[model samples]
Target chain A: MRRSAFRRSRGDAPFRLASTGAGVVLLAIMAAIGVFLVVKAIPALQANTSNFLTEKIWNPNAVEPAFGIGALAFGTVLSSFLALVIATPVAIGVALFISHYAPRRLAAVLGYVVDLLAAVPSVVYGLWGVVFLVPFMRGPSEFLNTYFAWIPIFGGDQVVGKSMLTASIVLAIMILPIIAAISREVFLQAPKTQEEAALALGATRWEMIRMSVLPFGRPGVISAAMLGLGRAMGETIAVALILPATFGISFEILGPNGNSIAANIANGFGEATAVGRGALIASGLVLFLITLVVNMAARLVIARRKEFARAA
Target chain B: MTTVQTGIQPISTGRRVKDRIVQMLVYLAFAIAVVPLLSVLWLVVKNGIGRFDLEFLTHSMRNIGARDAGGGAYHAIIGTLEQVLLASLIAVPIGLLTAVYLVEYGPGGRLARWISFFVDVMTGVPSVVSGLFVLAFWVLALGMPFSGFAGAMALSILMMPVVVRSAEEMLRLVPNDLREAAYALGVPKWRTIVKVVLPTAFTGILTGVMLAVARVAGETAPLLLTVFFTDSINNDPFNGPQMGLPLYVFDQAGRPTDTAIDRAWTGALTLILIVMLLNLVARLIAWWRSPAKRGS
Candidate 1:
């Protein structure tokens, strides 16, 4: 028995160590991403003749090395924010439809179909955006510009189809499935007892959802939207293909003048000189920081929701 | 009328109307979401059919120009397969082991909690950022050349968190009674996990790995930064630049000619087919082997 115990300890010790080592390696890689990007970005930041944060132009390969992330950052945040705004309510509705309204037999298949939207590669989305969405948007762009010209975003006269609004629309589509999937899962998990109680109180279907399901799922949906926002901000190829590459800090989303940090990197990396590469890395660093904060906040909300669930 | 008047009033018509409107909106929302998906699929199939022939599948763009009509994605397909395979090799074992740790050795322990939290954070890292990191550390700092292997490293980083998350869920679903049964039979914990627990969860773990592979196989940004671009075939991923399908589409689509655009569409079709097939197969496996379904 003593010998067998000794053998078991020896065997178990190595397995435990190997598993622990694997976990540690993952943490190490996460740390390395932040550290390496920062280290590489510093030289480019030092070489910049223009302000790195506020200047609008991106001329990083010039002899003077003038570049800035102001325009890229603006477009990234604005486009992602617009995508979130456009996608959230619709996503919630879709979630409710799946979890509450759809027949039980149909719900699983419908949910799977929505998931198929996410399984399509982003590059395909880019191709579709360029070939189909761009041309298709011209009509809507003209309509918005003609009718809603007073709006700052729709004020541009030329409806060049490859505008920030078009990109944001594509982004909204890309992120819709993500938000909807999470929201559906949360809505499905809404307490059966509470739902029954609301219905027994003579509540209509929508009222019952509004009072019980929606309130229960609110935190989950918010975190899901944040996750979607993070995805939208970091999406590279689709936005790169859709937006006409221009740099400016303007809110005219209807104009063909928008750029994002990731898109800029994808578009510029092919011909970037050393300093230019560094500039792109600097912009990527900013993107990384923004996404990290967003993701962390989402995680915090989710953590809190878990605690709240336990308490309730 | 006075006798009919009770303390409680009937539900308002206004609320009923509101409910009906909301229900319609909910259904409309679903229809709206499906429209773009159908459009994208329809357009890809329509445009891609022009160039998705045997010639396009077998040939490569060695000397083909942007206006040329006969280039294919053979090389890009090879590179994508090789890079994704390499990434899986690097990621799956670590991911599986980490998941085992999270589920078996240290559930809710400090180390496990931290690892779990950071895995979520790691999943949010942009593909471009992972690409940039590989470029900075492996290509620039280590003086390694742009190759499929570097791209694989970037892809592995993206794939790891996905693998861990899914595998961890699968591992958690393994019943405690099974573990107890193994322990009662004088089986060691390590042996129980390896011989019993892993075998039972094997299909689920395989499904998760397949899904992760599908996700990373479609990633282009990391490949753009790490693998660089090549037109001709490069079988050895460690030696030189590589072409991938997503990058192929990106490269071809950037050109102005009709032929290039046609090739880009075909490439997109191929990529979508690959990703969608993986997803379908993964879901099938999950459905087929689900414990609940088995019990039923």
Candidate 2:
């Protein structure tokens, strides 16, 4: 090796610099992306003070430049909420079954299947939703609306085929794999000795899980849910395929609530005018921050519980 | 006698009814989870199988609506291979080198700790965000036109973290005694790493690389922003639009015609098959190279 006269003495400084440099480069890239997005989006945000963050109008044909996020943000959160409510319980149960109850071979098969789902491309899921699934949701949506129309959230929507319900179901399908994988891992990591002690006391299988395993795993499951939430909030193609891009605030799960941050970005980005593109960038920045917060929150919840457990 | 029999039978019947309900629910849940997965696969096999003919696999994209209809995805397949292979080349070395640095040098130092921690943070970055980062840095700022190289760069960004983490674990498994023996023999650090340490962890490193490739192969967003698709094949990476299997799926599904929709299903299946093959190869390599299997 050629002698580096510069680092011949310390020998460690070069490697240290490289390592620290790599770390800084990674951080700098993330920070720079955030800053650039904000800087680029400033113009679009300036043009529409009232509509940029809150208004639901999205008509480019109008003489005035009319655009708003009220509908988009509502759609984003509602679909995510629907996905969370549906996936969380199923994920928890599947995790429980795999880690606690199922036969070893069966559990392995289940795990493989779920992980396989994660590998499915987003566009494929979207196609499946449009071609195979949305048509079926019509009957279900009507059935729910028939009895539960009195409830604001279940009220009838325009176009029974392409509604928030279709989008939400697709989102749920995508997030389930992630949530299940995390929860299964958490369940597996529950203090083995604690579980053994419960079983030794002749606690039935279900009761043992209820008492000893669950409390320790509660934080982990919550973290898993949060991760799933992050994914649901940002999922684009599947939602884009199914949702009608109607801009308004509607509580109905089966109704149009415009399009999500991601769906709107994907839908409008290709054809967007210069100002329109910047607005989409601004919206993208919002989505990015939301996901970042969700991720950090999940990490904090997991980290804090570990700290508390140690202290106790 | 009849009244007693009736009373006993009613109670048993109710208990059986409750048991059946629980059993049915369990099956329903399993079925619910499996339906989407299987139906998607079924669609792919049914539609994609016809498209998987030899000519289709080997040929380039045909012109639009000229009825030359049988050209293969050869260009796309070649592009995917080259990009992913290039990414693997970039990623494996850097990742393995960094991993070695951590394992060999770090006992409990601050620098090592930071590298380890930042890696975790990097792991949480969503794939789309990573795509945007590549776009901002490489395409927008550098004035590099979108190409296969850009897609490879994005893949490298995703591939690096996974490789670093997995290789670190693998390298750490090499016993300290091995290093001590090398030191006693007066072997230099770099020589010891190459001659003694790497041989032991080669299998694991290979596994990590294959998994990384599997991950990046199916990515759509990075390609969407960096190397957008072209209908006709361009073998060159530096100049023009290149197709990938994921992008093919996206293009087909986005249009939603009968023929296009069928093509999307086929592409999805093909992508899945490629991933499965890579995983299988990794597993086989790991098994074959394992010390116990070799009777080492």
Candidate 3:
């Protein structure tokens, strides 16, 4: 018995080592990324105060240079938030239809189509936005400018063309498929027993979804939003093509100009100095940190809700 | 009379109407969601179809071309394929092995938890950040020049997490009974995993790989950062300006020329076709192994 136990212990030794080795690798990758960003960002942060984060002007070439990512960050977050607001209700509703209400064949077709949209490249979206959506939105911007002109956000000097609103609209379209797909998966995973029980208890089809599907899918919906937020914040080609602002928080949502961190990086990276690269790295670090937090929160929501699902 | 009428009609009638409205609203929302999709597809087809031709596909793009005469997306097509394929070679093995370690070997251990966290972080990374990260390290830190190789490296960062997660899920789906059978026959842990669990999950694993490759193929940010998009062909992944389909669309669309715009539309259509092919392969592989799935 003792000899057999020793043999087994020997067998387990390599397993333990390999697993720990994998752990070290993950940590190493994370450390490498974290260290590089921090070290590179140091010079940029020193040259300008951390408050430069909020500074609106981005003249990298200026002696005693004035640079700040405030406008870009605001533009990114604002457009993403706007997109979330526009996409959420529609995503949840569509998900509910595909998961619970649609005929099986129709649901399959719908699911396949949404997946196709998800696979469409971001650059294509940029191209379409530039050619078709921008022109199409001119009329809508006119309408918004006419009716909601009193609202500060709607109160933009319309360049008689594309603006921040156009960017937000494009973002909304980009994130729609992500939100819808995740929510659809969540609704599909809702407890079959609970759904049947709801129906058995004289619940209507809608009522069953309201009670069972919504609760079950809450975490997944939040995760979906986090994923979409990450995409919106980090988006490049589409935002670059459409957002027209140089950089800064404008009160107008429909103005034909604005910029995001992603657009900033894409537009300036080629021309930027080491200092410029450092500033962009700082911006990237902040973006990375934000995404990490949001993802953790999303996963925590799912795991925490897991217990409740299992119990009910 | 109103009270009497309400009382006379079953309350179920009101409930039924409410259900029907909810159903209608759900369907309406889905329909509206499809508008952008169909509109974009329609526009791509309309504008892109005009640029499709044997010569247009075969020839390299020229900056001096006239509005009526189009060049080609040949260089970009080659660049996109080569960069993506190279990234796959780097990412897939490491990712698959890591996944095998997590599922079959690591289980719920501390190492598994860390791997899981990093994998999640990797998945949420914005494509722009991946490009920047690679730029920070490769261009700045290492003093390496920009090339398609750098683009491939950035793409691998994005591709790795998806492969690890998807491949892990498939590996987990392999029946435990198979592992036990191998063990009962005196098979080693590594051997059993390689022969039994892996073979069982091969189809699903292939599906994941296909999907990951397709997803990475469309990325514009990394290609923009690491490989300078040019009008002419460049074959070397390690040096010079390279053409890539997504970048082609970006560059040509930015130019004011009608001929460039036409080429950009064609590139977009071509990208869609490649993506569709990947999806089809993934589906076919997955369906073949799934008894519940019907052949398309």
Winner by TM-score = 1
Off by over 4 Å in 1: A1-8, A307-312, B1-11
What docking grade does candidate 2 earn? acceptable
DockQ comparisons of all candidates to the true complex: 0.78, 0.26, 0.55
Clashes in model 2: which pairs?
Answer: B56-B72
The most accurate candidate by lDDT is 1
The Cα RMSD across the true interface for model 1 is: 1.2
Candidate 3: docking tier: medium
lDDT by residue for model 1 over B113-192, one digit each (tens)?
A: 99988998898899999999999999888999999999999999999999998888888888999998988787888899
Off by over 4 Å in 3: A1-24, A159-161, A305-312, B1-9, B12-17, B62-69, B293-296
* Candidate 1 vs 3: which has more DockQ: 1
Tens-place lDDT per residue, model 3, B1-296, is 55565433443788899999998989888888889899989998899999888877887876655565668888899899889988998788778878877887677788787787778767777888788777878878898987888889888888888888888889878888888887777666766776788888888899999999999999998888778767777888888778788998988888888888888899899998898899998998887888577433
Q: In terms of DockQ, which candidate is strongest?
A: 1
**Would candidate 1 be rated incorrect, acceptable, medium or high by CAPRI criteria?**
medium
Which 10 consecutive positions of candidate 3 chain A have the poorest summed lDDT? A303-312
